[model samples]
Structures are given as C-alpha cells and as structure tokens.
Target: MAHKLTRLVPVFAVDDIERLCAFYEKSLGFVQDFRYGEPTYYVGLVKDVVEIHLISTSSPNARQPWGSGYLSLLVDQVDDLYRRLKGFDAEIVVLPDEGITAYAIL
Candidate 1:
C-alpha cells in the first residue's frame, strides 16, 4: 500500500493541560475546538489550518518524548506575532536578526 501523509497535529504533553490550553488561547489566538474533562484533553484551532492538541502528563501514553523536530510557520508579518507573543509571556527562543524573520520554539 502506498503511504500517504495527511495532516500533522503536534500533541504536547503538558504538566497542566488546562493552563497550556489557556496559554495557547490567550497568547497565540487559538480557539478552543473541543475539550474533554475540563480541558484535561483539548484541541485548539488557529486560522482554521493549524491544530494543537494538549494532553495531560498523567495520560496513559504521556511519557513519550516528542523527538527532535521543528515546525516552522511562514507568516508575512513575524514582528506582529512577536509583539503579540511578548505580551503573553511566550518565550522567544529565536529572535529575528535584521530581516524580520523570527521563530517561536514550542
């Protein structure tokens, strides 16, 4: 059978899933799509394209490492995102160097 790649949603194992969900919603402008058990399990949507799943650290399959990877988001205005994130305490792992090109490591 031919392997076909569909969509990729990063599942983040967080100590506090609810707090993480709130951070994404408040900081990254993501809307709550669906949540289970008071945000213990949650799916958030941003721009109707990107999806982020937040899972609690206590979940059954929670302790697995995400493996080394990077997801790059291409935006016309990185500065705007940078400013917005700064207000929400999102760590700027990489700062844009003179080209208005920056990255948010999550």
Candidate 2:
C-alpha cells in the first residue's frame, strides 16, 4: 500500500489576526470558519477547503521572519482573482507575467 499527500494549509504569523482575516475575506474571498478571543487565532475556508489558518504573532513563538515561505494556490482564473484583490491594502510581492504568477503579502 502507498500513502498519498493530500492537502497543505499554510499558517501565517500575523501581527493582527483580525486584520489578516479581513484581508483574506475581502481580498481573497475566504470565509471564516472559527476564531478565538481577541481574534488571535482563526481558520478560514475557501471553496469548502481549509486553505489558511491565521495566528497572532504577539506571542514570541508565533513571530517569524517574513518571506520565509511560499504558498501556491491553484485557481480557475488568476487574472480575475488579481483584479478582485486590487482594491485591498496589500503589497504586490510579485507581479504575474509569462511563466510567472503574482504574489501579495497582505
């Protein structure tokens, strides 16, 4: 028997979990599944999939260096998604082009 890799959910160290959650919800359209007090921790779902878990970086253990990891998402229309995210207060870490995709650090 062989085991197969199924899914991967990236956890982000965010300074403000609520802000991060709002960014994902407004910018990326991910829905909130659950959250803790002070909105320090939260789980978001997209298309019924648990795509991201936002955790507060106030704790010493939660803080980590930015640009230390990468998250790859497969979507039906990348251009449409990019357009939708344009209104949000997010930094364009990378812009999409031939053979490359855009990246935003929100």
Candidate 3:
C-alpha cells in the first residue's frame, strides 16, 4: 500500500488577517473559504485548486524573514495576472518573464 498526497495548503502568519484576506480576494481573485474567531484571527482562501490559510498575530516576528519563504501560484495568463497585480499595487519582487511570474501581496 502507498499513501497519496492530495493537496498542500500554506499557512501564513500576519498582523492583520482580515486585511490580508481581503487583499487576496480583491487582488488575486481568491474567495473566502472559512474564518475562525470573532475578530477573525484566522482565515482560509481558495483560488481555483489552490488554497491559502492566514493567521493573525500581533508579534512583529510572526512572519518569516523576507525572502525566507514564498508562495507560487500558477495562472493561465501570466501577463494578465502580472498586470492585475501591478494595478492592485501588490509588492512584485520579480517581473514576469518567459511564461513565469512571481509577486507578493505585502
């Protein structure tokens, strides 16, 4: 017998879970899947087959150091997504090239 892997969901620690979830919805086209806590200390977002989880924390060190981690999303239209990200004022650390793209919501 062999085990099968179905999915991988990355959880992010943020100072403002509500704000970050909103950004993922409005900016990246992700929909709200679920949320925990009255003040929304945790959230789950889904876009296509991908899912992301966010947890709120006031600690300044909640998130990993810059460049220490990243999330990669594969979109059908790389150029279109890049343009949309730029319009949304996302923190794009790398420009799209050769059918590949990368950006951040920070």
Candidate 4:
C-alpha cells in the first residue's frame, strides 16, 4: 500500500489580508472562499483547482516578514496565462530556454 497526498495550499504572509486578497482576486483571478477573524485577518482563495491562503502577520508574533514571497506556480496554458497577467501592473518577464531548464534541473 502507498500513502497519498491531496492538495498543497501555500500560505502567504501579509500585514493586510484585505489588500492582498484583493490583489490575488483581481490580478490572479482567484476568488475568496472563506475568512477568519473579526476583521478577517485570514482568508482563503481559490482559482480553478488551485487554492491559496493568506495569513496576517499583525499579531504578537510580528517577527514574520510581510509582503515578501517567491513562488513558482505551475499552470496550464503558460502563454495565455502570461498574456493575461501581463495586462496587470505586476512585473512580468518571460524566461528563456536556459532559465526554464534551470528550473527543470532543480
């Protein structure tokens, strides 16, 4: 018998979940699924099959860094997704063959 894994939801640290959730919804096409806290400090988002969670770092454990992340998301239709993302204000760059190969090698 073999164990199985289900889903991998990445939690993004943020000082303001409202703003971050808005960005994810607007820029990345993710929809808000649920939230937690009085002012909604923690929120969950879903885009197609992929889900993302955002947690606020404004608590007593404020040592957590805010708004700093590096993620490589694997998605279908890379070119179309790239074009859609390019319309946003985010910095978009196309990786050449060497750059992509580097990821593959890793």
Please provide TM-scores, in order, for all candidate models, with all chains considered together: 0.77, 0.72, 0.80, 0.68
lDDT tens string, model 4, 1-106?
Answer: 8978898888777777887787779877889899888867678999888888888887553356555656576776766656665676555554436435212100
Clashing pairs in 3: none
Inter-residue clash pairs, candidate 4: none
Q: Which stretches of candidate 1 lie over 4 Å from their true place?
A: 1-3, 42-46, 66-70
For TM-score, the strongest prediction is 3
Each prediction's Cα RMSD?
Answer: 2.5, 3.1, 3.3, 5.0
Which whole-number lDDT from 0 to 100 does residue 2 have in model 4?
Answer: 90
User: How much is the lDDT of residue 98 in candidate 4?
Assistant: 45
Residue-level lDDT for 30 in candidate 4: 88
Best by lDDT: 3
Q: Ranking under lDDT, best-scoring first?
A: 3, 1, 4, 2
Please give the distance, in angstroms, between residue 31's alpha carbon in candidate 3 and its true position after superposition.
Answer: 0.8
Q: In model 3, which runs have C-alpha deviations exceeding 4 angstroms?
A: 59-67, 97-105
Better of 1 and 2 by lDDT: 1
Better by TM-score, candidate 4 or 3: 3
Model 2 misses residue 68 by how many Å?
A: 0.6
As a whole number from 0 to 100, the lDDT of residue 45 in candidate 3 is 94
Give the C-alpha lDDT of model 1. Answer: 0.73
lDDT of 2 at 19: 70
TM-score of candidate 2 versus the correct structure, residues matched by position:
0.72
